[model samples]
Target: MSAPRFGRITAGPAAPAGGEALSELLAGGGARVVRIASRGQVDPEGAWYDQAEDEFVLLLRGAARLGFADGTERSLAPGDWAVIPAHCRHRVAWTDPAGETLWFAVHLPPA
Candidate 1:
C-alpha cells in the first residue's frame, strides 16, 4: 500500500493578531505551512518561542524586526526569509505600521 498524495491549496491569512496562522497550504502530512501577519505589537518580556519544531518563515510584505536571545537584532523586508531552529528563543521587535505584514511559515520536526 502507498500513502495518499496531496496537492497545492490556498492558505488562510492571519487575523489582526501577531501569531502564526495555520492553513492548508501544507497539510495532511507531517509538515505544515501557515500565513501570518503582524500589526506592530510587542509581547511581554520573557515571552519567546521555544517549540521543539523547527520553523521557517518568509516576509512577503511590510517590514519585520526580530530580537534574539543573544541580544542581537535584525530587520527583514519583503522577499526576505528566515529559518529558526527548534527550541530557539526569539521575539518580534517591530512591524511596519503603514500596513500589515504578510508572512509564510513552515514547521518541520525531527523525523
Candidate 2:
C-alpha cells in the first residue's frame, strides 16, 4: 500500500500575465482533478470547448463568467460551482482583471 498525499488547494504559483495555468492534482479510474489559476484570460473568439467528459468546476477565488453556445452566461464568484455536461460547448467569457481567479475542477467519465 502507498501512503496518502496531502496539500493545500490554494497553494500554487501565480498565473502568467494575461494567461491561465493548470495543475493536475489527481487522475485515475477515468476521473481527474485539476487546479486552474486564471489571470484575465478569455477564450479566443468563436472558440469553444467541447470536452468528452463531464466537468464539475468550483470557483475558489476572484470571479468569472462562463459562456455557452446558446448565448447564455453564468457568473461565478468565490464558492460558486457549476456542472458542465460532456460535449457541451462553452467558453471562458470573463475573469477579474486585477486579481487571480482560482478554480477547482473535476472531470468524470461520460455517461
List candidate 1 segments past 4 Å from native. Answer: 1-14, 17-24
Clashing pairs in 1: none
What are the lDDT figures for the candidates, one per model? Answer: 0.73, 0.94
Q: Quote model 2's TM-score.
A: 0.96
lDDT of 2 by residue, 14-95 (tens): 7876889999999989999999999998998779999999999999999999999999999999999999999999999988
Kindly list the per-residue Cα lDDT of model 1 for residues 16-111, writing each as its tens digit: 655444454655457787767666655566688787888898988778888888888889999899999998899887776656777788988655
Question: What are the per-model C-alpha RMSD values against the true structure?
Answer: 3.7, 0.8
